[model samples]
Target: MPRKVLVAYGTKNGSTAQIAQIVAEVLSKAGLTAEALPARSVTSVSSYDAVVVGSGLYAGRWHKDARRFVRRHRRSLAPRPIWLFSSGPLDASASERDIPPVPGVRRVMDNLEVTEHVTFGGCLEEGAEGRIARMIVRSGKGGDFRDFTAIEAWAAHIAEELAGPESR
Candidate 1:
């Protein structure tokens, strides 16, 4: 049977959703059945072999829905291979080390034995901002800073890992 994977994300302004779609595509290419869904829509993951969850970081914290999903499904997710990612940091120069997941998020990582948590550069498009975001933009803190190549490479690596000895 084909391995099934779930790519769930919580996005603000849609960039993280695009990232999740790319991840699901990469997993599909690796011969795994994968689907990308918003965290809010996913009620259960018992049917999947693995799960990848991501969220847009806000002020160094994950989106509330993503956090809640992890909390709610912790038991169901514990037995599966799980990967976590955070999409944040509007600066192009931001590195993974510079954007570690928040403390609350880190707790889940430890509980799940997640080896690593990736932090990707974020995109903030014009006219997609709220009042505070607009104010930050006026201070020169906005643009499309996502590194697609990095995201793709990471997804491909996940696919390879999930593929196991047969694919290698």
Candidate 2:
């Protein structure tokens, strides 16, 4: 049996939403029931055994709706294991220590006590699309830097951690 998992997300240009869907599917395939829903639509977290919250970044900060979602439900989430993910950071090749998410983002996780936080590169748009990603990562900086294999791999780890050895 799989535990109910809520994968909530907030996206601006739809890239992060796509990433959330991929993560939900990956977790589902790992024997965990996962559903991706927009942050504004998810009214309650009481039903889920675990949660994975992700938000797209804009202007070097998390999306506002995503911040609100965590603030609204942080009390409920503290008792349960929670994982936080941010779909930003155009650079993906940095060493673990060099990740800005450490000191820069510690305060964000402190309120919710997220058991883990993951950062993946943001998605880019081509010339005709004219998405924000291209503007931010100009000068040949950004692209669709999401690592599908890495995403699935982490989801599997989360599933195993939550389900326990006996269940797996």
Backbone clashes per model, in order? 0, 0
lDDT of 1 by residue, 1-168 (tens): 339999999987899999999999988988889999999999999999889999988887888889989988999988888889988888875444556677978999999877467888888777765787777677778888888888888898888777776321
Cα-based RMSD of the predictions, in order? Answer: 2.5, 3.3
Local accuracy by lDDT, each model? 0.84, 0.75
C-alpha positional error of residue 114 in candidate 1 after TM-score superposition, expressed in Å? 1.6
Q: Which stretches of candidate 2 lie over 4 Å from their true place?
A: 94-105, 127-134, 137-140, 165-168
The residue pairs in collision within model 1 are none
Structural similarity to truth (TM-score) of each candidate:
0.91, 0.83
Clashing pairs in 2: none
lDDT of 2 at 104: 35
- Name the lDDT value of residue 13 in candidate 2: 73
